[model samples]
Target: GAGVSQSPSNKVTEKGKDVELRCDPISGHTALYWYRQSLGQGLEFLIYFQGNSAPDKSGLPSDRFSAERTGGSVSTLTIQRTQQEDSAVYLCASSRDSNQPQHFGDGTRLSIL
Candidate 1:
């Protein structure tokens, strides 16, 4: 893909179930980010991975959320013990570096029932 790619455009799961979302960044992008956006709310940063450096997970809202970037190309975000409040659009973005402009994927819409 020319741009960032995300899988499972929509997800519906039970409140206590877990879900994993995937993202494939551009070929040479060194920075990847995970964000969540609730209805009518702005994007909430979740985590960031850059090259071989450790990931910055400071923006994660709770222990239930976690993400990993493998081989500096693919990333996955996992949400455990999901709750209704966790419903939102999970977005993935990539950039050449921290200071570069990011290209975003369409996002995976998650709905907790």
Candidate 2:
């Protein structure tokens, strides 16, 4: 139950609301990644956190989206001023290292009404 963990498998919110999605990676795993998949769309990379290095935030679409990893273990992705376009499945994955294959958990489905 520890390869990778995500909370609140599904969430529903009104437009303009803010939400936080959480991820807990396996012990000793130093790399974490976030992705988003919309209905009928391919998954898109959102961010990456590797060890103690600065997180790679380039993949995030806008300022409204951001993520942070604390103690290189758990991560939280926050979406501010959510929009209808934000409705999608938010996936989390982790790897022992950056070049290794990552293990993913069931994603959190966010719905904006």
Candidate 3:
């Protein structure tokens, strides 16, 4: 509600199970982004949505990963047929615009068994 908010701070699922992570950005932010952080790795950009423009999916690791922003306020990241390699902290960030600094959420810790 105040800053960026992510659902289910932690998630554990069996391999091959699909999972969806949600992000609720600040009230008026126009830019939303999704990133993944492996154990010691830096944030890996996954996707970006700005206003009504087309989302930039260039950073997505595979076809099984997808994300969408709705009504310019909320976003969802869906991972299909999850694998062990997919286990990581999924982070969400939002900014007033693409040029502005972002506010990050605590992130969802996903574990694949």
Clashing pairs in 2: none
| lDDT per residue as tens, model 2, 1-113 | 55788998999999999999999988999999999998767799999999745458877999999888899899999999999999999999999999999999798999999
How much is 72 displaced in model 2, in angstroms? 0.7
Error of 3 at 9 (Å): 0.4
TM-scores vs. true structure, each candidate: 0.94, 0.94, 0.94
| Sort by lDDT, top down from the best | 1, 3, 2
lDDT of 2 at 110: 97
> Looking at candidate 2, what is the lDDT of residue 68?
86
Give Cα-based local distance difference scores for all models. Answer: 0.92, 0.91, 0.91
Worst 10 contiguous positions by lDDT, candidate 3: 46-55
For model 3, how does the per-residue alpha-carbon lDDT over 47-67 read when each residue is reduced to its tens digit?
A: 889964546889899999988
- Indicate the TM-score of model 3: 0.94
User: What does candidate 1's lDDT look like per residue over 1-113, in tens digits?
Assistant: 59899999999999999999999999999999999999776889889999745468998989999888889899999999999999999999999999999999999999999
Cα error of candidate 2 at position 89, Å: 0.3
lDDT score for residue 56 of model 3 = 89
Model 1 ranges with Cα > 4 A deviation: none
